[model samples]
Every structure is written in C-alpha cells, then in structure tokens.
Target chain A: MIKNQFYVISLLVILSMILVACSGGDAGGTSESSGGSESEAVTLKFFHKWPEPEHMEFYEFAVQEYEKNHPNVTIEMEAVADEPYKDKIRVLMAANEVPDVYFSWAGEFSWKFARAGQALDITDAVMNTDWKDQVILSAVEPYKLDGKIYGVPMRINAKFMVYNKAMFEEYGISEPATWDEFLTACSTLKENGVVPLAFGDEFPWAASHYVGDFNAKLVGGDVRSADYLLTAPAEKLFTDPGYVEGLARFQTLVTAGCFNEGPNGISHSSARSSFIAGKAGMIYIELEEFVTVADGMGQDAFGFFQFPSGSGDEGDQKLLTGAPDGFMISASTEHPEEAMDFLKFITGPEMGKEYVKRLGIPSAAVGAVNDETALPIVVKGVESINTASGMALWLDTDINIKIVEVYLPGMQAILNGTKTPEELMQEVHDAAVQAQSELSQ
Target chain B: MKRKFLNQLTPYYFLLPSLILMSVFIYLPVVENFYYSLFRWSAIDTTLNYIGFENYTRIFTDDLVGLSLFNNTLYAVISVIFQVFIALVLAAMLEAHLVRPFFGTLFRNILFLPSVLAISVVGVTWQLIYRPDTGLINQVLRAVGLDTLTRTWLGEEGTAIYSIIAVSQWQWVGYCMILFIVAIQAIPEELFESARIDGANAVQQFFRITVPLVRETTLVMTTITVIGAFKVFDIIWVMTAGGPNHASEVLGNYLYRVAFRNDEMGYAAALATLLFVITFLLTFIQLWLGRTGKEN
Candidate 1:
C-alpha cells in the first residue's frame, strides 16, 4: 500500500509541472476578450533603433504611458543600435514577419518595406488625427507614396559643421567661409596640437556626408537629385565632371591634413566623444545631436556653422542635407487603431514638447521646441531648418540601399587614398547603371 | 523474432532527433543556398529571374573573389603551420619532465582561456590594443623613442591584413596547443622510457617517438584550425570592417556585406556556395594527405 501511494504522488507532481508550463505559455492569448467589453489583450510590439543607455528611459516612459492609457494593450518593446537595426529590419521584412510598430528612415528605406507589402497604410488613420497640420508636411513628404501616408514624422534634422567655440577662439579662427580659409584653420588647429576634424567612417554613411556636401556645391541640386536618385539612364549615370571635381576637392581636404589619423577605422560615436573631449576642433553633427553634445561639452563651449560652399556656386549653399526619420506601423499589426493612437500621442505637441525636452530629439511637431527651454545650439538648429531654401536628402537616404553600398565604401576608398577620384566615381556609376538595369528588368 | 527486430531498431530511435535537426538546420539551408544562387533574387519580392550559370560566371570574373581566395589560402597555410607545428613544440614542453604536472595543467587552462571568450570582446580588446593614437603598442613604441615604428597597424593597406592574421594566430594557437597537450599526454610512458634506455637523447626521443606518435592529432588540429581561419568573420568585421578600401576583405564578411549591404542576395548566395566548395575541398585534401602519410 505504501509503495503504491509513493508512485501516485510522483505521478501527480509531474502532471502539475506540465500543467504550469502550459498555463505560462498561454498568457499571450485573448482570454480576457469576452463579450467585447474590453477588447482582446493584444501584445503590440514596439521596435526601434535608439538603444543607447540614455534613451532607455525615454522609451520606457513612452511605452508605460501608452500601456496606462490602453489597459487592454500590452506593449512589447525591443531596441537595437543603428547599424544592427538596419540589417535586422531587412531580414524581418524579407521573412514577412514584422513588428507592429517600428522606427524607419523615410524615402527609399521605408519605400523598400512599403514595396514589399510590409508597411501599413495609415492614410485614413492619419487624416483622422487633429495634429496632422502640426507636422511639417515637407518633413513627412519623403514617407508619402502615391498620395498615401506610410509613416508619422518623429524628428527633423539638418547637418551642421559643429565646432568647439573655445577651441576656435583659442586658435583665433573664425568660421571659414571659403576653402582657403578652411585649410588655413585646419593648419592652424594642427599646429596647436588639435585634430582639425574628427572624421569617422565606420558607418561609411557618415563618411558620405562630405561627398554629399561637396556634390551639392559642385553639381547643381537638379543634377544631384537626378543621378543620386538613380533615375538617370546608363548613358547619363554619375559621369558628370562636377561629380569627379567634387571628389577631388574632398581629396584636397584629406591632403591638407584636415582630418585626424585613421578616419576610416573610427566610428561616429567615438569621433563625437573625441570632439566633446576637445581633442578635435570640429565635427559634422546633425541637429538632433546638439542637445546631448551641448550637455556633454557644456552649453557655452560648442558652436555650429553652415557647411561651407568652398568657392563654389552660392546658389547651392542654402540646400540642407537631411532626411526625415519617422515611426511606421507594419502591415502585420492587428491593433492598428491602438498603434496609431499611441503614435499620435507620442508625436502630438504635448508629448513632442516632452520628447524635445527629455531626449533632445529635433521634434517635427510645431511648438515642440522654443528658445526658452531649448539649448542655444538647438535654437540655431531650428533656425537652420526654418530658413533653409530647400532640403537635399542625404544620398544614403535618397538613393536605394544598393547604391549606398557603393557610395559609402567609395567614400572610404577616397578617404584612405586607396582609390582615386576617377576610380571611385566609375565604381559608383557602374553600380548605379547595374541597379538601373536590374530594376528595368 | 519480434524481440530481435525491436532490438535492432532501438539505436535508430535515439539518433532520429539529432538527424532530423541536422537536416533541418544545416542540410536544408545549404541545399536552399545552392538553389537560390542560380537566380536573380530580390528581397523586395519573390520574383526571381532565372539567368542560369550567369551568377557562377560572374564569380569567376569578379576580382574581389580572386583577392578573397588568395587571402583565404594564405590564411589556411599559416594557420596549419602555426596550429600544428608550433602547438606540438609547446605541448612537448609541457609533456616533458621540465615542468611539474600541476604547472602543466595550469598552463593548459591559461592557454585555452582566450578561446572561451566571446568573439566581440576579443575583437574590441584587440582593436584598443591596435589603435594608432591611443593604443598600447604605439604607446610603448613612443616610450622607447621608436616612434617611427608606430605606423597605423590596421590603417595602412600593407599591414592591415597581416595584423588581423596575427590576431587570429594569437587567439587560436593556444587552443590548438591544448589539443596537442591532450594528445601528447595520451602517449604511453614506455616508448619514451625505452628510447631513453637505448641511449637516445631528449631531442632524438622527441623527434623519433613523440613526433610520429602525435601525427594524428596534428592532422585533426590542422583541419579544425584551417577551416576556422577560412570562416573568420567577427574579428575582421568588428576591427576594420574590411576597410582601408577592402584591404582586409575576407570571404565571410565580404559575402555578408554583399548580401545585406548591397541587397544582392543571389550574388551573395553564389559567394557562399563558392566558399563552401573551397572549404570543403581544402578539408578533403587535408584528410587525404593525412591518410596517405599514415599509410606511408
């Protein structure tokens, strides 16, 4: 009798363990969705790229606020760094499995997902919102396709030549307006034991900024948009003399000792840290990075200037190099209403103010930033965006990802002096021609 | 008759799970890779253009492939030499009476520690050590006033590939040593004793006895290490990203960049297939050489 009782007890214990495991696995099911009183307990995935230590609190706050507002919805959040996120998003889309809401770059990046039937069409939902006009329409224009909305604008940025005010003052160098003056400043800075520019090319896109800036100055904006957008035929591909001239001028900067050693091996974050440490005289920074940088380098230390045209046509000086980064919902989301509502709440003016205040993101929502609470550098950033004649989309953003693969490493080749201007441009032109042929096929 | 039949089928039941997993994860992907390599596959859509054999033809014409193959071959040769020959020397040192048994175990564990580390950690640590401006190597060179010797270790085209190769050597040489130590320990005590009794010196005993006896282990270690050197990705990816204008582009990271960065999945698949064939052939050759030598 005793042996039989022991056997029965052991069997009961194993059954209990399996029962617990099954129950734990079923928590994500819609058990709480009877009679449509409070809708199904849906777990909405929120994925994004800002996984830095400081940005964690901002994301947690946003998710917690959304969950509190919608008790029936549970927000499952994930974040990755920028480069990994770029690769991960492609793999996710290729597999036909996407998060409910994810951060995406506008233009060809979002269009790839949209073309793949992975992006959600939020045209009607966006029209229903009251804050539609508050978003800078031009900022969100890149994400629009066929008169349909695919993303909500989360940030606006314009590139600037960010310099340490104290370093420039110590060197007695004002902002250089011409190429000669820029070289003079670089030489002076080097003489004083400071790196002239903290150039980092690890992302390679970061290196392409100079290429874009130089190309903007040399070839007119129309020519740039035509070739860089990869719309031109093989005969009219990136063979423009101005394109080669722009690259040669970039080589001029490298030869002039303007950049620190080993630019291609460094990362943008490390370069930024070096700039903040006053090891470098200047770095090219985006508007969104101003506040964090100012906080690190002290508010009175850093200053920014417009990208110098370097004795080129004055007409191209006003063109801003930037892109609209925004939040887009995927087609796989069951809770479209809840997701849109949450995005509206985040991008709305009230949350926009807090977003700008806390994270220092360059908010696209009107009244998100002001002269009072904003850093002085941010005030200048806002003014730069407001007064810009026209925005020139970043080449990596405007062009297809295929061409970016060529352009980025080509820039690296140019910087490293491994490939000449002619060689690099020929490679880029060939890549563009190949891509055009493929798309036509 | 029923009992005998059931007994024969019992071992297969135990192997079914592993066989199923290997087919699903490894064999299935490889077959799919081969199938996909024949088409012009786009990530945006499933519309594939079946331009048969064009992709393989392109691989032959591609200059990057030539460079990568040369690099991989060089890497395999060096890795085999270091991992097999050098590891035997170190293992013999520990095997002999010069070191205490307790010290031998300690040395073995210490040598194997780097292989236990995550690749990312190892790559980043090496980068810090190799950095031009604020690196330990450059700092030491400067301190000794040999500042001219402190050229960018990974920035210049000539040195970048070799520097990365040196790092791989540092990481795996010790791992191969452990395998050697294990094999050397397993050699019987009587052979060395008998050789010594015959008036053989330490050098003679090592070359005649220990060297020939551990030949099998050398084959195994060389096979593993050579294959490893061919598939190296993380260190190159993290350290230089095949940069300084593709100076350090290895086969593994090159295929990855082509696949994800260029969005040419078909071409990338073809590259992967070529790499697979190359590695497979190299391993087959190693095994063949081992068998021939053993027969001799």
Candidate 2:
C-alpha cells in the first residue's frame, strides 16, 4: 500500500509538470495573438546600418517627429555600424528575432527574401499611400520580384566623380570631356605633384565601381540589354567589347600612376579624407558622401562631374550608376499592420524631405525637396544625372551576389598584378556560371 | 540484477547534464551545419532544398578557397608556436628572478592591457601605428636613422599578414604569460633546490625541471592559441578586411564574406563545417598529446 501510494504521488507530480509546460507555452501564444489583434500602443524595433553620427542625428529627428504625429506608436531604433550590420541581421533572422522593420538594399539577393515571403507584401498598402507615385519607378522596380512590392526606397544616389573645383581651376585643368582627356588630366595632376585619383584598390570595390561605371557608359548605359545578358549564360566578360574597352581605360589610368602612391594600401575612408583635405585631385564616390564632405570641407570645397566620356557622346553623358536606399517590413512580423503604420509615418512626405535635407543625398520621392543651402553640390550632381540618358546600378547590385564575392577579388588581383585581366575575367565567368547553375531550378 | 544495473548506470547519470548541454549547444549545431551544407538555405528562404555536396565541390575547385586555407593554417601554426614559446619564456623569467612583487605586478598588468581593450580599438590603434606616411612607427624609424627599414606595414601584401600577427601576438602574450607563470610557480621549490645542488645552471634547470613540469599547461595554452588563431575575425576584419586581392584571407573572414555579405548560406555553412572539423581534429590531438605528456 505504501509503495503504491508513492507511485501515485510521483505520477501526479509528473502530470502537474506537463500541465505547467503546456500552460506556459499557451500563454505565450495567447499574448502574441492578442498583441496582433489589439490596436493598442506598441513599440516596433527598426534596425539599420546607418550608425554614423550625422546620419544618426538625422534619423533621430525624423523618428521623433514620427512619434509626435502618432502618439500610440513608438519606433525603437537599433542602428549598427555598416560592416557588422549584415551579419547581425542574418543572426537575428536565423533566430526568428527579426525586427519589425529593417534597412535592405534593392537587389536580386534582397529580392529573394521577399520571394520567400520573409519580406512583407506592401504592394497594396504602398499604392494606397498619399505619396504613392512619388517614388522613382526604377528605384522601386528592383524591390519588386514577381510583381509584388516588398520595400520602399528612401534615397536614390548616382555614382560619379567629385573633385576639388578650386584646385582644378588653380591647376588650369578642365574636367575631362573624353576618356583620352581623362588620362591627360590624370597625368597633368600627377606631374604637378598631386595624386591624380584618390583610388583605394585596397577596398577592391572602389576600383570595381569605376570599372562598372566605365563599362555601363561604354555600352551606352544599356541596363535593359545588360539585364538580359545577366540572365543569359555568358562565360566571358572580356568577350564583351564594352568590358574590354572599359578595362583598358581603367588600366590606362592605373598604368600612368594616376592613383595615390601604394594605391593598394589606401582605404576608402582614407581616400575620402585625402580628397576632402585637398590632398588628392579626384575620387569616385556615391552621392551621399557629398553631404558629409560639404559639412566637413565647408561650403566651397568641391564640385561634381559624371565619369569623363568613355567613347560615344551619348554614353559619356549617361547617368552611369545610382540606386535607392531604404527599409522594408519583415513578413515574419506578428503585428504587420501596426508595423506598416510605423513605416508609413516614418516614410511620409515631411519625414522624407527632412531626411533628404539632412542626408545631403537626393530623395527618391519626386515630391521631396532639397535644402539648397546645405546641399549645393549634391543638388547639382543629381540634376546632372537626372538629365543624363540613364543610370546604372553599382556592380555589387548589378551582378549576382556570388560574382560580387569572387569577381571583385579577382579584379583586385588584376590591379595588384597577381593575375592578368584575361585570367581574372575567365575565372570570374566560371565561378558565376557555377553559382548560377546551382541557384537555378 | 538491480545492483548490477545501478553500477553500470552510475557514470551515465553523472554524464547526463554535460551530455545534454553538449548536444544542445555543440553537437546539435554541428549536425545542423552538416545538414545545411547539403542544401540551398538562406536566412530569408522559407524552403530549404537539398543540393548534395555542391558547395564542397565548389570550394575544392575554386582557387580562392585554397588560398584562404593556406592563410588560415599559416596563421594558426605560426602564431601558436611563436606565441606559446615567447609567453613561456617570459613567464619563467618573471617567476624566477622578478622578486620585487610591486614591479612584477605592474609590468604584468601593463603588458596585459592590450588584451583588455576591444578588438576594434586594438586594430585601429595598430593600424595608425603601421600607417605609411604619418604613422608613429615610420616617423620614429625616420628619426632614428632607420628610414630604410620603414615600410607600409599594413598596406604591403608581403608584410600585412605578419604585421597583423605581430599585433595579435603582442596583445595575447600577457594572457598566456600569466598562465605559464602560475603553472611554473606551482612546481615544488624542493625540485629546483635539488637541481641546484646537482650543479645545474639556470638554463639547464629551466629545460630539465621547469619545462617537464609545465608540459600540460603548455599543451593547454598551445591548443587555446591555435583555436584562437583559427577563429580570428574581428581584428583582421577591422584592419584589412582580407583585401588587396585577399592577401590576408583567413577562413573566418572568408566564411563571413560568403555567408553574410553574399547571402550564400549553404556554401558558408559548408566552409564553417570544414573549419569546425579541422579545429576538432587539432583539439583532439592537443588533448591526446597533453594527456600523454602528463602521464610520462
């Protein structure tokens, strides 16, 4: 009887433990569902890679304003430095702890997230918004795969050359009008004891940006054809006359000792600093850098020009490259409606203009206006690109992700003389083909 | 029968908690990694499809993978041998002759200061020191009439990896040094006195007595250092980013570039699993050697 009673007691204990575990799990479920349904006050975490002080200040002001307009909703901003941002986001996603909203580039790789239903389908909601048509179509297109809009573009930047206008005039050098003229200018700057181009091959992509722009321009900024070519099976970028010509032009500048001494040693920020400090003659940088440069270099520091003409007149004058930067709602969000509301408030007209005004980069929204006094060069730079024949996406975004990891380093090898252009191109083609085949169904 | 069963089950019960923890944290993840290596998996992808060794095949065929492996192995072996040896020697010196407690403690703390700093801070600080034009190292070299020896340490392809290793060694030496010092101090004073009576010189005493006594400690430190070198990401990521045509590519950084930056989760998983296998084998070897040395 005693042993039987003991057995009964243990059985009861185990039953209670099971019941507790079940109850605990059910409570978690109930809270999530209740939170999703209720229209009560909520805080949505928004993660981004913009951790720079100036950029941080701008977003802080915009988000605060957003909160003021919507009393019930609060945006909790979690910003990480650019280098670690992607890894942080990946870890968060893998653990199912993704933020309500986060910044993502508009690309094939980012598009996969939306296609997999990881990104919220914001197509209908975005279309019904007050400033629905304000976003640039091209900037918005990259965010859409299979005709579903998953993100909103906030900033559109064009790739171009920024040089010190005062220094250029002082040295009696004009902005190059052709590829030949560009080389002459580089040599002239070099002979005059100024670094011709603040090229930082150490970053690799800095050099790739120039080559990407040059290639695009050489092909008449033929994005449509390039997109088609990208989708097709091609083994050789060198076989493309445009690519070879572009590479030759890039090598011409390198061979002339146009870049800083020990070009492979210079970093992107170092190059930026050198150019801003009036130490280097030219640098290839995104449009957003103009705001920081203008702020740091004071008002009358620099001027902008499209990458000097490549071959044909029309191609030379083309936009060359630019893209949008913005945030998207995570589809895994339990309270997606509330998340969209937060996004709507943050990306609204007032916030958009304020962001662009503070950002110094051009707004993708057509209705957004720039503060001229703060962003003279940026404004002029945008105007030049907008009036051009077309805009090309940066190489990282233009090509597949696998190519970016492989081809970029290979190109760097060419610059470092570890491999020739022909060898690097062949290797890049093989790697890309293999990656594409694996990615394909 | 019950007693026999209890005797057989005792060790298993004792091992249960640790076994459970290992399965949850280590073994399970390692299995998952191997599983992922054979699939098309991304953080964003809802559906994972099995692709069957494509990722591993790609790595074997790629030139970049070979280069990265070479760099990783070079970093691990070079840093481990040099760092452990130097740390052991310094610890012996401090414990043997540095009888002034205050000065010894101060020096030890000062040397360990770099290890305490954040990796990013250490990387940036050393980068400035290695800067070609306005860096203090180059400036000091010029001032001392050693201008010819001055070079862009972090910029040059030939010297960048070595320079980074030097910085890593400088930061971590103190950590190992303290460990060695503790191990050496625990050796009985009687053994040293007996050796002294036998007319053994200090150097001979160090080799014959101190070295053998601290063999286990040496093995543990060497293992840790090897693992630390294999997993080195932060300082190199911040400093050079495995660039200038990947002259400084290590397995960790290369895996990072593949996984996060490129969004090739499966390929990166394959690479990471390979790295884990390599580390596991090396650690097993270390443990085996340590046990053998201790037994002898």
On lDDT, the leading prediction is 1
* Interface C-alpha root-mean-square deviation of candidate 2: 3.8
- How far does residue A270 in candidate 2 sit from its true spot (Å)? 2.3
Misplaced by over 4 Å in model 2 are A1-30, A33-45, A71-76, A91-100, A120-130, A144-149, A220-229, A235-238, A313-317, A331-344, A371-373, B1-18, B57-59, B96-106, B137-152, B188-201
The digit string of per-residue lDDT tens for model 2 on B101-193 reads: 647777778777877889889988888788776678889999999989987676666777888888888888888888888998899989988
Screening candidate 2 with a backbone cut-off below 3 angstroms (N, C-alpha, C), the clashing residue pairs are none
Tens-place lDDT per residue, model 1, A1-441, is 564465456556655766776787567344422223346676677889988877778778878887888888788889999878877776766665578889998877887778767788988877766657768777878888778889988888888898999889887999987777888888999999899998877557887777777777778767666786667768888888878887888887789888887776567888898899889998987888887688788878988887784466622877777877789998767777777877777777776777777877678887888865577679778888888876767768778776777777778778778779998888888888988887778
TM-score of candidate 1 relative to the true fold: 0.90
Docking class of 1: acceptable
lDDT of 1 by residue, B63-156 (tens): 8778777777787788888778987888888778667465887887787778888878888888778877787888999999999888667776
Off by over 4 Å in 1: A1-38, A127-129, B1-14, B100-110, B193-202, B286-296
User: Which residue pairs overlap in candidate 1's backbone?
Assistant: none
